[model samples]
Target chain A: MSKFKKKTATSQEIPTSALPDIIFMLLFFFMVTTVLRETEIKVEQTLPKATQLRKLEKKSLVSHLYIGKPKQPEVYGTEPKIQANDVFINPDDVVLWVNQEKDKLFEDERDQITISLKVDVETKMGIISDVQQELREANARKILYASIKSVDRE
Target chain B: MARSKRGEAGVNSAPMADIAFLLLIFFLVTTTIATNKGLMLQLPPKPDPNQPPPDINKNKRNIFTVLVNSQDRLLVEEQPLNDVTELRSMVKDFVLNFGKPDADSRALYNSLPNSMKSQVLRDPNSSDHPGEAVVSFKTDRGTSYEMYTAVLDELQGAYYEIYGDRVGISADEFRDLDRKNPEDLAKYEEAREGIPMAISIAEPSKVGGE
Candidate 1:
């Protein structure tokens, strides 16, 4: 009985000695990774992984086009959706939206505008192709297919 | 009571950890990990409605066509390909082919080291030079986005591999080269002088697709 009590009772006190250090470390990690999202993402997105990826530069010149299924499938239905500015964007309005986005930028910088396509991996190409066609009509020629960087060959 | 009655009592430190915890929780809740990186592509300009399309003739040997159907099955250059990974080396081989070398390509070929020179298989039935090689990537409307991106990644990886080999650097290092740095820019320019990464995304066909 004495041996067991001595062995198990060495540190009954929950060690608060390193608690502050752990908390500070976590705080620093969060601080470094913190990118306050400008708008809430309404659709579910799981970015495809790729070994060959280039960093998208100049955020001001980049326009985002999100394609994925709605978060609440029961309410929004199962059809894949396109989103921009945290709102559901209709396929028909893509061209108009792109043109409007282009207009928001300076005329000289407009030529360098790149549309980033953040698409869900499981999404069908039909809607994406339609959007591409619409983007062509809008004259937004440059596009970036957003992918998560991975070291694995897969 | 005696310790508390001491004139110089140490300040309490019990609440310090709580303050840190609060700050940590705030940061964790307020932000997210944002990633903005991808494979960049240029779409073909909108075609003129009235005028006839330009009739530019390209040799059959120079075009490397890759097709992805609704089922995500690949058909590469008239042959059905099962695996996507095989496309990298195949594309690299096609781009490096010096079948009917012109004066400019001949000069470029001569500049290559003997080791690399031996590797360039002179397939007469294939592309004459890197400049002439055009990869036309086509997909069916029902193809999944995952397969599309995977194919694009392989095609782009092939170009990067060629560029890296030309400049005697690994592809990853070449990618990391600073565009703003004059020295790095010069090296990149030399690597890509004759070979432009020319990948054309053809309009997706509606046949056998949703």
Candidate 2:
């Protein structure tokens, strides 16, 4: 009976050391396998007010396009040519730039593409229409326009 | 030698380590990196607050309006375009003729400048007028995700054809335009910069058929 008890004790001791190593390896494995979320561009666009707003799914691929006042061209001299600085054009240029970037980002057909257009409230319809025209030209089919939910002025 | 032969009743520690290492390697090999996708539309830099706002309303009439309702219908000035191809051609004509010196007949300008020659020639500073199309799209609020994207795709395809043709490179060759000569690359980049893809929204009217 004494010999039987001694044999059982030795068997338990072997597993004790192995248990901690297994747990540690598992923890490390999970840490390494975990995927981190990606960062996206943050810009303000006026979203239309809605009574119901749907939450997007976790894996949805959404591309962003923002339209606002055109930034002044970089000034070089003390007295920069104000004419160059003052010239404001449509958002078509920005769209073109975005399309080129999108082409590079989504080279694989397996990945889904979504375009979110964020336009300022006061911007004319013509500018947005031109953007849509450009999107069609670029073969970017999925599009979402962001608008602020309207509030009653009263 | 007699003691070594006495007992062999336990699993070896080395084998346990080997198993742990194998499991670790399996997990490492099986893990996949998550990826995101979509059309990367470049936004214009913000306007300097000190500068006065441009008069967009004054030129609204000159600008063509293409509405993509929540239903994904394409309308030009309230009239539906025949198809995506027609819309593209119409927009190409409009953008190409925007600031020409000839003032009298704007509509006739579309026919005068035969599209074949014009599509192949691109000005380095002419992103705004890529093949004569300047279109603005207003999407309704209740539009479905699929419809909105389809409309956007059609519009982008048109622009792509115009820009692609003007650059005088096939899609296959143009794909590597970035990796080509520095001057050609700069020309491509310059032509691409500052273009707009602005989309606006209005209070969605309960229109029929999405």
Off by over 4 Å in 1: A1-29, B1-11
Candidate 2 at B191: error in angstroms? 5.1
Q: What C-alpha lDDT do the candidate models reach, one value each?
A: 0.88, 0.47
Q: DockQ for all models, in order?
A: 0.57, 0.04
TM-score of each: 0.87, 0.39
CAPRI category for model 1: medium
Over B1-210, each residue of candidate 1 has an lDDT whose tens digit, in order, gives 877776877777678789999999899888766677898888889999998998859999999999999999999999999999999999989998899989998898887657567779889988989889999999998999999999999999999888888889978778777888999999889888888899988889998666
- Candidate 2 chain A lDDT trough over 10 residues, lowest sum: A77-86
